[model samples]
Target: MYVMTLTKSDFEAFKELIKVTLEEQTETFLATKEDIKHLPTKDEFYSKMDEIMGELKATREEVVMFSDLNRKVNDHDERIEKIENNCVILFLFT
Candidate 1:
């Protein structure tokens, strides 16, 4: 056996709590809608991607130029080494 009792004041308090909760939920939903409106769209996303790819292309060109410059420096170093070797051989023979 169980006995329960709810007073008029208790019902009023419960109603007030439900009203406040519903109001807060509605406000939260409206705030979320405002946030969604400010989110990036598909066109904006594509523009960002294009900007990144442009930067990447520029970086790739710079890398190719650096690689070519490095190869030239290596070739110059090899030539200098060969000349030094020849000089040493000539000095030893004479």
Candidate 2:
């Protein structure tokens, strides 16, 4: 084991360091509280969220409609191709 010794001056300097640290931390706590006070109220936040959700729902519906239309277009294209092939076959036979 090792023994260490501190002078009176060393003790006073240690007390000063503790006081400075507590003061800095207290200031930081107060600053954080002040920052939190500036945040949006719960109702305001909820309304903004609602607006965004509404827009997302509308966009989702539009996407579904577009997908259905795309499926119909592909079906129509297949039907037209079949009709064209039948016409060509008839012309060749005649």
Query: Which candidate achieves the best TM-score against the true structure?
Result: 2
Whole-model lDDT, model 2: 0.95
Which digits, one per residue and each the tens of the lDDT, describe model 1 over residues 12-79? 99999999999999987775656779778999989999999999999999999999999999999999
Give the Cα lDDT of each candidate.
Answer: 0.95, 0.95
Q: How do the residues 56-80 of candidate 2 rate in per-residue lDDT, one tens digit apiece? A: 9999999999999999999999999
Residue 94 lDDT (model 1):
100
The candidate 1 region of ten consecutive residues with least summed lDDT is 27-36
Candidate 2 lowest-lDDT run of ten: 27-36
Which ranges in model 2 have alpha carbons more than 4 Å from their true place? 1-3, 7-12, 32-38
User: For every model shown, what is its TM-score relative to the native structure?
Assistant: 0.54, 0.73
What lDDT score is found at residue 66 in candidate 2? 100
Backbone clashes (count) for model 1: 0
What's the TM for model 1?
A: 0.54
